[model samples]
Target: MGIEFTALHWIYVVFIVLIIGFMVKRRDTTLICIVGIFMLAIGATGDFTSSISGVFNSFIYAITELLSTILIISIIVAMSRVMMTSGINEVMVAPFTKIIKTPALAYWTIGLLMMLISWFFWPSPAVALLGAVLLPVAIRAGLPALGVAMAMNLFGHGIALSSDFVIQGAPKLTADAAGIPVGDVVSASIPLVITMGVVTTIVAYIFLRRDMKRGTFLLNTVSEENEDSTQAMEENLLSIGQKRFFAVLIPIAFILDVMAMAVFKLQGGDATALIGGTSVFILLLLSIVAHKSEGLEKTTSYLIQGFQFGFKVFGPVIPIAAFFYLGDVGFIQIIGDHLPATSHGIVNDLGVGLAAVVPLTKEIAVVTLTVVGAITGLDGSGFSGISLAGSVGSLFGNAIGGGTATLTALGQITAIWIGGGTLIPWALIPAAAICNVSPFELARRNLIPVVIGLVVTTIVAMFLI
Candidate 1:
């Protein structure tokens, strides 16, 4: 039977076209998402009352599915903030500073720290903390602000966030769409994630070295006056004893958490729970250490600040994710009431329809999926587009033969690595803002290396998966 386009499907297509137009014009994604949702609701119900209700229901559903992960991320961010405000962030990176006296070492050190911290606390909080403390040191050690930003983007957002071994956000979405265990996605992603990280980091290092040789490297450092200002900021944020305690306690706690997670078979939600529970414990500890008598009030204050930071990091991406979520049959059925009960894979159906009209080979399919991933990543949130990729992956993979999950994972990685901010100007804003570099410049510097790494990773996945 020929696939017929319903009003709801047409509305989705139009919404996608508008969103793409908005992205090309460098307009706001959040605004586009809201408009897209409105269009989808109206198209599906064809009645104002039901359309309005559908919009509200979709919004609520989106938030409900995401709330647990968001809350966990927020709490971890709060812990990082407490660590930073308590001066633990400085102490955490101090050891690396001594070892990373050169630009090369500084780049790797910063990347490693970002990966480690992101694995535990997630990239959002990790970037904030790393930028606040480690960026200065790396820059002073002769690493360019652009280079530091690139490393953080690749390692934290691209690698750690993609694997999501600790929090499992990315894996959860992919697994749900594929009807596989989250643990399967997590396990399957690790080798791919590691390959991408190593290739990307090495390529980035080579580019940085080439730039250094050409004397195009920019030194990052504060003036003596600015150093004094920074010190003052530190003093106001942390007392001597509080600084000392956290300086000792926070790292030890994180190391223990890692060991425990590894020692135990904690996976999926359990892994995130472990990290969140630890973050709360650490938050309480820092509060007690920092505020003493007013610890309760102070801890609550820090948590509020952390939530604000988390929302700032994640809030803008949620609506975009909601729109993408509709692309999944599971979610499409919820949103598109008239969809057939037998229509198990809506994304596959759409891809198949397109495939029939447009000539597509295996290589073309792979490239198309990669490009789609990169496009989805334009909103600068990596996990947001994963469900779409997973859905598309299954469709194309089955058509091509076997290895649907593998291709889906590859597509997911590419989308996240590129649009997740490693090589896109607008997407890199958060990391650029934290590193005090021009986001455009960082994106430009990152493009070649990241692309090379992505190519290598895709090829590797084709064989491995």
Candidate 2:
């Protein structure tokens, strides 16, 4: 059925436009989103008093929805801190760094390794795993820190996340939305994903190489040796024996975690849960070992620090996410189930509206589906909007006589590539923080390649259909 396009739906659309405009202006949209939530609530409830409560409730709901993601990042960061302190973090990556003697090798090795780890454990956790270890090595090997960040971002967030082959979270969302089997979505995504991945990475890499050749990408303000020396001094408190033991033990532990994930066929939340749980255990064990009687205090201190970092990063994100969460059906339960059952979700309604209004030629359908997917990704949480993409893809496919799986895969590819972290500052934070670069700058660097990839992938998708 087509959407009725209520006043509330129109309001959401207007606010979304405003949000994108604000993003383009490089202005914060958090307060704007909060106000949008308030207005939308007032419109939905039509009671001034109830609408006031809706504002707080929307934020709370947003936090609740994001808590798991925040918590896992926090826990993993805490574990990383402990490993760094024990010097095990350095040890874990030292062996691999030796093979990365040249700048080209540094770029490709880090990118490939990041992709591999991200495929299994997801990118956020993988960032924590490799950031401290691989970053310095890449820097020392003559890879600009920014280049390292790009490799990690493009490979992990762009390539691995867009496909999400090992975990299947992305595929599951797309498949469910499109009313197709997960296997079909995954299968259809392979060529599109590879096309997007290869084109984007190569373009980005070429840009990087040109900059390096021109000396435009040279390390600035921080000599690699000085940075390495500082880190070495900071971590020198740990005894060689202790470092060796933890280094050996930590890799074994993570290897076991990886094996367990494979054995249990765990992906997404389950895999993250296992990783988080293990990180916490390792954090506690290492803290206790290091501080002995004061281990409890140290553990608490570390956890507090981790949470501070996590929540600080999440503060700007929450309000923005709150506004978008309202677009999905998932929020109805939190917003209240007492509303008219006929209320369609904002994103779904928008998709349906597009299907109803747009002319349904093959070219129009392909382009429209890609555009819809990109619009959904503006929310910054790539995973949240994919289901909408899938839904819209299915609608477009049915209307235009294309393969539903092909359309769905195109939608998934576009959504994840844009929102999964490559071009969005909020989504790009993990990689940016790892490489000590500005997220905005990183996003700016990513924009050209990703857009090119999307265009190429969309063209390939039209053929697949």
Candidate 3:
């Protein structure tokens, strides 16, 4: 509590506000984040060249920290691309169409399936995995394209990604910033994620149904376009039998990996490694089987596609993440040992400092973190600012002397629910595009339900804390 608040701290705080402001204005935060790193470095070391080098160093540190996440997502995307192009994905999702006869059945089935697939591969790849194949089927059954987009967004990006039980990327980032165990964050998130997912999806469905009765949602299949795309993708490199074979084998292999994770009690990096490895194997197997004589070249091509997707997804996140890292262990590494002797990292010290000045309460902490998380998420990556949430949660937890994990989880839920594709038009692109719906319309449809869910989820998190 006696930690000195230095120019470094003030600089960090100012930039945090600037970062949030930039995000709110829908401007790029990359330049500000870089400027922030330099500012902090210069504030700490009082040298020009050192500040310059520190900016680059922070980038290296951020990229190094983020490399594993990038690799896993890339590998999964590559696997998904091959599945989608090879016709295996078509076969894989065919069974669902038979069960999706009614509108209600179609909505729930598609949502649940998307959630399940999202848990394993995460949402982007999950979209690539089966959304295209399932969209027309659900649409034919009377679920509007917007409704399908909602189900996929709420379940896949909202629920699966928020909990991130399999990938653990979300937990790892928050946990590291909060200085807590990944297990604590993951365990604490379960009830909150469930509450949010259930409430939001149900609310969204309710509104969707009400509108359906009025025939508000117009049905358009874009079937010809979809078929044309499919025909173009079909090089017929894979026989129907081979397509069917992979359609069966691919799920089985991933299922086994999931089983192995459970059997070994694997989490975080270990679990991510297992998933990434299996994806690589699947990608290789598919590329070889589908491309035969040119399999090697095809494999590389798929990897390139995957890497492109991965970097594109994460590229916006890196700079912001780098700037936030300095609030934790990254401080000493990037800017040298310049913090006050009593300082317990910038974020931790801020927590202590705040607690010392204010009469902190769980209620206030809950609302503050919820807002901070949502504000940070205005960037729409949902990921770029979770470290800030973790930092702030850690801060408040220190002030209150408990509930770090709960607060961190709450922040994660809020941020991801807001910007992870549910209410954000741009973030909704994958599901929207796949379902042939307007992303803005999808976002508008999601707003009420998501807000209701966030309110409910925050209350639940309050009780947990």
lDDT of each: 0.72, 0.75, 0.87
- What ordering of candidates by lDDT runs from best to worst? 3, 2, 1
The parts of candidate 2 lying over 4 Å away from their true place are: 1-5, 116-149, 160-193, 207-237, 337-346, 361-448, 463-465
Model 1 TM-score, all chains together: 0.86
Q: Taking the tens digit of each residue's C-alpha lDDT, what string does model 2 give over 1-465?
A: 634667777787788677756644556677788788888888777888877888788778767856766786677667766766666756666678889988899989999988976775568767767776777778878888889889999999889988877556677666655656777887788999899989999999998888889988756523455355326424644677887888788767777988997898776567667777887898999888877788899899889978886786567667766676676653464455433456456655565566676766777778877887787677676665665567667666666655778888888888778888998888899888767788998999899999999999889887887
True-vs-predicted CA distance for residue 372, candidate 3, Å? 1.3
- Indicate the TM-score of model 3: 0.97
RMSD of 2: 4.8
Best by TM-score: 3
Question: Model 1 misses residue 172 by how many Å?
Answer: 2.9
* Residue 156 Cα positional deviation in candidate 2, in Å, after optimal superposition: 4.3
- Cα error, candidate 1, residue 73 (Å): 1.5
* Poorest lDDT segment (10 consecutive residues) of candidate 3: 226-235
Counting only residues 3 or more apart in sequence or on different chains, how many pairs clash (N, Cα, C under 3 Å) in candidate 3?
0
lDDT of 3 at 156: 95
**How well does candidate 1 score on lDDT at residue 55?**
62
